[model samples]
Target: MADAPQTMVIVGGGLAGAKAAETLRAEGFTGRVILLAEEREHPYERPPLSKGYLAGNSAREKVFVHDPTWYAANDVELHLGVTVDRIDRQAREVHLADDGVLGWSRLLLATGASPRTLDVPGAELGGIHYLRRLPDADRLRATLRTLGRENGTLLVVGAGWIGLEVAAAARAYGAEVTVVEPMATPLAVALGPELGRFFAQLHQDHGVRFHFGASVTSFEGQDGMVLAAHTDDGEEFPAHAVVVGIGAAPNTGLAAAAGLELATGPGEGGGVAVDGSLRTSDPLIHAAGDVASAEHPLFGRRFRVEHWANALNGGPAAARAMLGQEVVYDRVPYFFSDQYELGMEYSGYAAPGDYARVVLRGDAGRREFIAFWQADDGRVLAAMNVNIWDVTAPLQALIRSRRPVDPDRLADPGVPLTEL
Candidate 1:
């Protein structure tokens, strides 16, 4: 007798979930596949939410990962606007909020994450937004269109990528923007202190105000809209609207309840713990995207990276591993940001004590340069390029291969990176 068809059930409908589904089809898996998404819309690209989408440069229709026809043609089942409330690991079943249980041979949890909210007075008031979904961007875009930018003050909380991107969008619309960060400089945690200082200066040059080492204590609202916010330093600033881009907490409650090991390390929070194969402790289950804290070969650490490239790259890697053809997740981590007229690109890994030399190419004063981090053994550990892209690709290849290059040669702008 023939064996029963394999059934693969995927939870979440973000980039990771969508990419996994596409990969399964591409691998010629003719099994029964189901995708469950809580959001009503199709899976879409999220990076644009803070930039082009906010600036009206890209339309909502253009952001979809794959059109409806593609999914239909692939025989993949999509359960849109439905939430998966529980996971029954024993039965390999997923309990849906809409009164249904999905049985599966293999389960992939790509539940993704939600924006972290600030615990402050009047935070529930209107005119305060968080940009994570399309609806959030739509609402903010409408406000920008109606208020005409210059007519309002935009207060942004946190100096992370999302906050900085939103600040850039608001400033582009001609609004007066102020960013409040408890750290001494923007992106301090991710880029370290020196690069963080450069980021702070980058934004300051574009007319964005930075309130460093200041924390928001309370929010003041009038007529259902936020009017001002009080800081820890006993100071208050008036605002027309507020945006909180502090960070995100992974959607891992269901996975934890199902007895899957979750990430608990320093940078890992609310994300599932996965092995090098991207498989959870329970081999029957797998995790990916922002919800999976898989081991990073380059950094010698395990942490969740909230980046578009990771979602696109890691999703397929996890899917391939799930299919029993294991692939090493060793790609160099890469991410980019666009704020004002500056375009910054980061490639490779930078961990404490991993680098012994910091080489600079181009002019830091002109805000167009590349900083290469090199280990004492002479391997390129990481590279941060601001408005400089010509040399990044070759440097990225060398970093991934763990190739050694002379530090002085790397700093020479006139010399080719390949020669190093």
Candidate 2:
């Protein structure tokens, strides 16, 4: 049995760590709670960094997870702008970059992910930005405005969620956007080529040019500023500014240095490995958010979801588990995105080969529809509602049921989703 919790320390100041701190106090744990944040800013959510905040639709203050005073008000020690150098797991202590030491009975590592950059030439040039933090968004937002005013082109690398969102935001600001992807369609890996083509069409309709089936060979720059991007096909796309949205890699350095067990499999998001309760190999240590690859009870496999919903929910779940409460973290993976006029909520997990086909319930041409990725036997693996609202619960329920449904009725607009 776990010892009575005493001092609890949480590393990483993102939404996961913040929510974990909140949940610890709400659970009536009287132990001292110390939250160590590497970033100088208070805990904040990152979705807006790519969407609203990037578009200037959401204020900077709106991204924070809690008010500045809330940490102190709840007796939770908040250490901002502090870096944890190493974890002395044997001593149950965390050593700070400043040489400070903090003893803890339980520890949580919510060290979120970092934006992955291109390895090609001129990748380090100025005017090339990657969006992952508040400051990144701040810089990109300013660059977009400048590009928009000058009628310049914003070159986007990769056709993933971040790239597409940035493309949409760039267009909204009246700047030209050109997306270069090695894949044939945007979001092909996540949404499949069919829906991926749909997204490609959406952006193409808005004047965003796409160079599909191409990869960036090098970035052309002058005097440390990027000028354009050269593709593998020898095509050159002029770029006043470039945004690299290849992907993000989980910040697992600290945990790995501590000798904690980590997931090594491909596509597992490469994070600290945890069980259903978010407990790592070491009983006294746990990890959540983008840093954790948790064994899900429902899916019967380890999954490290980097979406905002995972961080928002994983932190609290790990906290309850840390408190020795009966806990099972098996939330269906979820994420949302807003690009141009398209708003979408995706629930459940269905990779390319996992699902046999996609079933559509509404008109795809009109861009108001629900798409379901199902198994060969018609079991719902994942569902996405585009320009749809208030159906998350039912969609999640269908995924949880794990039972096959008639594809014909599933594709019928007359059939209620709850019936599935």
Candidate 3:
């Protein structure tokens, strides 16, 4: 490409931003690259925040995506603890909090998301917390440390991924943990009720309690510290520490302010809607990671994924698009999680209620199984393997093939997925 942009600026110094910067230089782009991170530390992974970090299994330095010297060596100008106020799309500039500005030929909005806050009364109490940044995980680990040293109670609101991971960490640290969710099953929207109940049973076997179909109305405490949770049904639960993980709200303020088009209609999950090339409504602007609601060429619908693999792959795809190269972000979505002794990996794209049946291989009772979800059209929508290894490749292929499958063949351990 001749006369490429002079400068490429990436907003939000998370995994996506870091990868985008890496991809630019790797693609032979010699332009100035500035990666702005709101945090004072180097870009780091977020999954460990609840699993390894909070459980005292990961060291501090292990979380960083790269060493401090990597940025300087790669000529990637790194700015930490900087607040970007707005995107001046008209002038191709980013306004800083202190009224400074940086001109960019291309802009990538990797600005992730924030934890959804509970609207209940006494929400500001000290013992209640949310996990998003490294500091939040650090504080929760400290609380878990105290609980491990003695004994305490932890009330976790919402049964989403983060909530369940935190609950597993807290319980592992010797805390008596209780999780509350308005949904009858945890992750009902994602995994459906059958598998969700399997997870509920897993937690129960590990000594964790659950309050299903319950809503929190307020928190009661003394000394401005959360001590108890009050439910709408007039039930009082002891809560020495409260951690909320309802879900994440995408940070799309700058995109909205810049007049970038967003998703619309029922299937349009909200965010900056982008095409297969990851180009937003504004040609000069690109949105990746959690902030981008990019249309999936495979699913025939837009999907904004917030998993590690998406951020890892989408960043480079967006960078290629920014460089005037032809690229389609058609990679099947993938995600993995660890809870207690169970390690599960899932791949494919399926919105809520897209799958009609789940074909199970191996026994769910033995904690070693693969659940393959199929749509009404007989296509494999998604699949999850617990305590299974090295199977995501074929699982992804099955999804990409989009062919009808025999349930018996799908459930046979002797049958290789490729044959199906």
Candidate 4:
């Protein structure tokens, strides 16, 4: 008698989940590949939602990971608008919200994260927005266009990547923009104070107002529409529309309910704990993308990264591991941002306190520079190249090498990074 064919179940329809399914077929996995997505639309990438798509530079078709026909052609089962309510680990069954159940030989969780919302009053007002899904971006794009034509004000909360990116887009649309942040400078948590100030100045140069060291205490609205925002500093700014970009929390409710171990260490970002191979506590299950707190071999730390690059690579790694292939899943953390004419790419990881000081090469004033975040012992923890090209390989190599570099040589444009 022949054995029953193996079935692999994947939850979430974002980049990670979609790529995982594609990888299964690419690696010659003849078993069943079932992908369940809560969202009605096909799997799409998120970066364009905040960048080109929001700016109206890219069309809607460009966001999708694969064409609609690709899934069926590849013999992968694509179930849309279906939510996984519960994971019965003991029985290896997935309970759907619509009373459907699926038994899987292996499971992969790539549920991703959700945007954090404001607790202030009037947050639910009609003019407020959060950019996460395709629908959200479509609404935001229309709102920005309307505001621009009317010469209205756009109040953005938080100075993080999303907030700043939207501000840039709004400016391009010719809407007046104001950003309110609790931190001293924009991107302070990720890039430190000095570089944060540089970004602040960049936005300021483009006529975007900044209200730093302030928090929104309440929002004033009329007819169920947000009209203004009030800060704890006793100030109020007129807001025709508002966009909240406070950050995101991973979708770990399903995993936690199933008794899967979660990363609780400070700064692990509260994700499902996975080993270097992206395998979860139960060997039959694995986690990837934003919801995965993976133990990294290179950094010797377990961290969760919410970025397009991570999702693009993590899903394939998890799929290979699921096939019993050797996969370390130790790619350096990477992310990029585009605000106006400035474009930057950052590789490796380095929070504010993790690095001693920042070393710069090239001209920062001209916005063409490479900044290195080095530890006290001169080991490069991370590197960011602003408006620079063709240097990601050498920068990442320096990080993986774990070799202390001479600050003077690193700062010299005459010295090649590969030589250093």
Misplaced by over 4 Å in model 3 are 1-5
User: Cα RMSD (Å) between model 1 and the true structure?
Assistant: 1.7
Against the hidden true structure, what lDDT does model 2 obtain? 0.93
TM-scores of the candidates in the order shown:
0.96, 0.98, 0.98, 0.99
- Total clashing residue pairs per candidate? 0, 0, 0, 0
Candidate 3 lDDT over 1-420, as tens digits, reads 577558999998999999999999999999999999989989998999988998899898898888989999999999999999999998999998988799999999999988899998999999999999999999999998887677899999999899899989988889999998999998887798988999999999999999999999999999999999998778889988999999887898888988999876575658789999999999999999988898888888887888888889989999999999999999999999999999999898766778889899998999999999999988998999999889899998999999999898999999987788
- Taking every candidate in turn, the Cα RMSD to the unseen true structure, in Å, is 1.7, 1.6, 1.4, 0.7
Worst 10 residues of 1 by lDDT: 142-151
> Highest TM-score: which candidate?
4
lDDT, residue 15, candidate 4: 98
Task: In angstroms, give how far residue 155 of model 1 lies from its true place.
Answer: 0.3
Model 4 misplaced stretches (Cα beyond 4 Å): none
User: Of 2 and 4, which scores higher on TM-score?
Assistant: 4
lDDT of each: 0.86, 0.93, 0.91, 0.95
lDDT by residue (tens digit), candidate 2, 322-360: 989989998999999999889999999987788898999
Greater-TM-score candidate between 1 and 3: 3
TM-score of 1: 0.96
| Top candidate when judged by lDDT against the true structure | 4
Tell me which residue pairs clash in candidate 4: none
